[model samples]
Target: MSEVVTRTERPAQRPVHRPVFLTRRRTYLWAAGAVLLLALPFYLDRFWLQAGLFAMAAAIGATGLNLLTGATGQLSMGHAFFLAVGAYGYCVFAGDGADGLTGLGLPTWLAAVLAVLVAGVAGGVFSPIAGRLRGAYLGIATLALIFIGQHVLFNARDLTGGYNGRDVPPLSLFGLTFDDRELVVAAVPFGSAEKLWYAGLVLLLAGGLFARGVLRGRPGRAMNAIRDHRVAAGVIGVPVARYRAAVFVLSSMYAGLAGVLLALVFQRTVPEYFGMTLSLDYLAMIVIGGLGSVSGAAIGAAFVSLLPQILTRYSDLLPLVSAPGTGGIAPGEAARYLYGAAVVAVVLFLPGGLVRITARRNRPTPQEDT
Candidate 1:
């Protein structure tokens, strides 16, 4: 009766793999970067802070461009027009009828929000044409926007202050005004730049996260599909035209927000500042950074925006670079040349742009096959 065999069960084996997203190393790196950013205002001077603010603005604008041009395959040459709208719109909405400029006398915070909305509305007005056009045709169509915008900016003296432009009203929020008024924090003099440093960080963080979410979700898939093959996207029930128009408006809103930050930094909004050259620079940023990549856009923006500043700061020490109007290659021109070469090199060899280099280093390699 005792012939029953005692069977032994093997213990369950644990899973060998961990989730690739947000791994320990990545989490640590992000934490370190955040800490560094938070501490920078205390250590760095105003020059560096302003330069960083410019980079942040550029990043915001470039991310929007990438969404439309890189992800959706819609070429836009009038991004600067929307930027101008935002800058001038804020001045008009917030100004108190001073210096021969028109003003709605709204609160600064409301003006900023309305300025962004105005940019979106401007984009919406152009959507019909954008939805129908593609490739070079679309680009050419958008070029007209620059000319039209410039004309209006010059002629609408009360709104844009004509050739001279207009001053940007200081932004206020939650009982704190972002101006040159000195407020000490932790023994640090928090002026407009210092105060705006924190504001810029928050805005950049929010914009990047929102953009990342959009790219990682269903809308991004639809956009990529439309970019890859429009007819196929439509066949698969994607509303190609509607999506294109919507993206244009969204991109314009982003540019608007960037313009607001820039206006605050400079305390002035100039038509010349938002011109074809600016649009071209943004295109260069996305191209050099990586198409359809959020981080790439930011990286490219910082590189392009900072190169000139760095060169100017050390122009005397650097060969072939001199201060503006010094007969040698100007700092801006030098930076342009360097980045122009970088763009060509990226297109020729690294089609994926700078982001690919980072991705490759971070990618894990497989061990020997069993």
Candidate 2:
């Protein structure tokens, strides 16, 4: 088509490097896992099912915080505060309000939704400190929030029910009350645990998928970039502070969601439950499960959530080692000691977390490939 002796222009092309690991095979596996989760409550017993429900909640919270700390390099020691906000928020909005200042008397579901938003706003309020701080300094700032939150929780008598803790109304889904185990699953016997288990499973899966989306998407890349080199990322026009603040707030929202689920499971909302210990436990869950990995978060959540109960059942099986001050090996003391040791053992050997251990079994090594 070009005229004789006419010069032809060439289209410019750039080399594209696509990651081979992300294939259709991986997506299918993920889908299967999600499907399995949905069907879990159908088969499991009440205790296991309830444990699973709580584990998923913890896993969701851990996954979000992991994104902030492990993926985005931001530390938060006040996560329990956000969780407490969620728990109490549900209680406040849904409870009878013995004093009656302003109770929404809203439906449990709607109240829960409002509670999650309140938690997000609470996080947003602390965004500036989180945005400005880093490392131990950030931890200190967040720790202060947890303490301050506890103080406010105690002082806000009209709102928080003052130390005694307010009762959480049983959740109802579409004219069905969840409290009456008999009503949880009308047609099926042994359905309440299974029903709640299924509910927890769905929320967790949704949370996991959401986490996966954020981690694998642009924001995830940006978070990783900031985590690796903040100044460099900033130089490249990434809004580092904005992302940090946003993530902290987002993480808090995740924590709040977990709290809502927690209240649902316990059927009670006690501010004391969301304390420093719980914050530590959540951090431990991520570490033991695998930081920055959704699979790890779930795996870790199951482990930490179930460990206490499992160990408590088997405490008598272990050699009784009485403490220096204790007469008989106190169940509480034994549990604490065992828990500390468990954390130590996991950190010492499984530093990469339980996921790496699980994955290594299936993934071929270079030697195997050769």
Candidate 3:
């Protein structure tokens, strides 16, 4: 016998949406931050402005390194090599053969673009090796780049100006040269630092946004898959080697752009600045901030880059720190010591990096039954 049954219809549930105010609040915060950054150069002295620019440039490079080392699980100790290529490449392309140096006399903007490309090419040349290796093996292969770059930078006298390095041609964009020409805005005298402040902000913002996109897109998923399990990723039809190579090139290009910005800010391209130490600092940035996170890279870059400057600027006011060469725990040394301790503390406790703190705080609480 067939059983008699009745069916009860339920009302359709609406899709859950976040509170409108939450989105509005984020937009408002972003607007406030942009306004603050734009206004900073007007009130800040040159020293502070320069420091901020340095931080921004470092953040860009660190972001790229994070994409490779953190996201792809590829260790790179040759980031400084690409940066050197960019810095020196710009000097060559824009130098105009002045001061007995070789140059193509190209437009400053074109030179910057070409410099980034040159860096990408450099990475492409090494991509095969990166594709084949992983972990410490890849790192060791990349480390050789630093030595090779050092030799080229020192010996290529006509291109690099030997040990002294070369002057960076002031960037000229749309008839306004980013030099110490003393342009005034709102009664405030604007120099290279002031002009480059806005440029640095723009570059950093663009880089951050692009990185965030990559991190959230399909490439990011493939990268994470490769990172988590290379053989499994390959088995799933992901081109693990190709992705690794592409990411390496992309990371190199980012470092190159950062190098160009740094050269513009300093008005010079020095070989000594782009070294193993700089690469290590970039690693420290990603690790201290949060691996595989753009905001984390920026935050870590700011902390790592600014700490030395802050210590030096206010050494007298702080204990266990003094002016450079004055002999009582020099500010630079002290800064390093402090960051080293911070790294240890972070590894021991906050393995997710400083950004995790905010993430943990922002996480929603689970509701309890009444």
Candidate 4:
């Protein structure tokens, strides 16, 4: 007799519909953070506010650099040069041709926009080189930008105020001035640092969101493809050179915005601050935070930028750190050493950087049943 086989039918499973945006826990965390940020200016002093502002600016710059070097695999060593361009560009656009400086005396808002554009133009000018070169070659070529920028910043006194630098005109938006002039709000005196704190927050939020969108969109996919294999990406019809150049311009604009915020925070643009060291610091930030990650860049920026400030604040309690000129390792130097070691350690151990640590902690481990 012939044997008959029966087919067993399985029950259909419904697709799980998870929320695309924030979950309840994340929303609560975000709300808490916002409340804290809103209240910080009232409680924190100028020093802490200034330090936070610096971290915000660094985060913006690092995010841009991450887009280029980290996500796109394009080596860039001229990030600080773009920052200098933005800082001085803002001065030129906003200055009233006073103090023997050349300026257009544009509106503060217009000046800020123009400064960002100027940085984009500067990057475009270098795009040919950026588009053609890759890896260490591109990095070496970009290194020239720092030297050239330094020379211009020092010698072009009319434009950049030379070695002594120039004062940054206060930013005015909707009649509110981000200046040292105190504006009382909720019984708290809001000075330049305090006012700029809000401005910095706005800028950082916008910049981070925009960069995240870019990273999560079609452009991001193309960039990743080019990063993973340039030849294969090109064969698949990706415009390798154009994408590289465009990313360079975009990255420069981000740096430019950061420079403007930094100038506002410092109230002065010092040529010495935007040097090779600054560029290296940006590189270290991306490496330590996590390459190809927006949150990683921001996290790295805060860590690196805040380390020196934290060390200085508690130098007496720390053995290896001391105030500047105290003979011991200066806080800045100590920060550098710590981050340098972190960079090496991350590369050797966690190739994904510090972001992976958080990821690992959040990941659930599989359980084995006996």
> Which pairs clash in model 3?
none
Clashing pairs for model 2 are none
Query: In model 3, where do residues sit more than 4 Å from their true spots?
Result: 1-18, 367-370
lDDT of 4 by residue, 112-229 (tens): 9999999999999999999999999999999999999999999998898888999999999999988889999888999999999998999999999999999999999999999999
- lDDT, candidate 3, equals 0.92
Model 4 compared with the native: what TM-score? 0.93
Overall lDDT per candidate, in order of appearance: 0.92, 0.80, 0.92, 0.93
Cα deviation at 203, candidate 4, in Å, is: 0.6
How do all models score by TM-score?
0.93, 0.83, 0.94, 0.93
For candidate 3, write residues 32-93 as lDDT tens digits. Answer: 99899999989999999999999999999999999999899999999999988888899999
- Minimal lDDT window, size 10, model 2: 14-23
lDDT tens per residue, model 2, 1-370: 8769668788886444333453455678879987887766656667777777788789988987898887898888888999999988988888765555346788888998898999999999999988898999999889998888888787787777667666677777787666745643344564556656767776887888998999999999999999999999999999999999899888988999999888888876666888898888888778778878888888877877777655555655656744335565755556556556767877898877888887766564554444
Q: Clash totals for all models, in order? A: 0, 0, 0, 0
Q: State which candidate has the highest lDDT.
A: 4
Candidate 2 off by > 4 Å: 1-44, 98-102, 184-187, 190-192, 316-318, 321-339, 342-348, 365-370
Instruction: Kindly give the stretch of ten consecutive residues in candidate 1 with the minimal lDDT sum.
Output: 361-370
Q: Tell me which residue pairs clash in candidate 4.
A: none
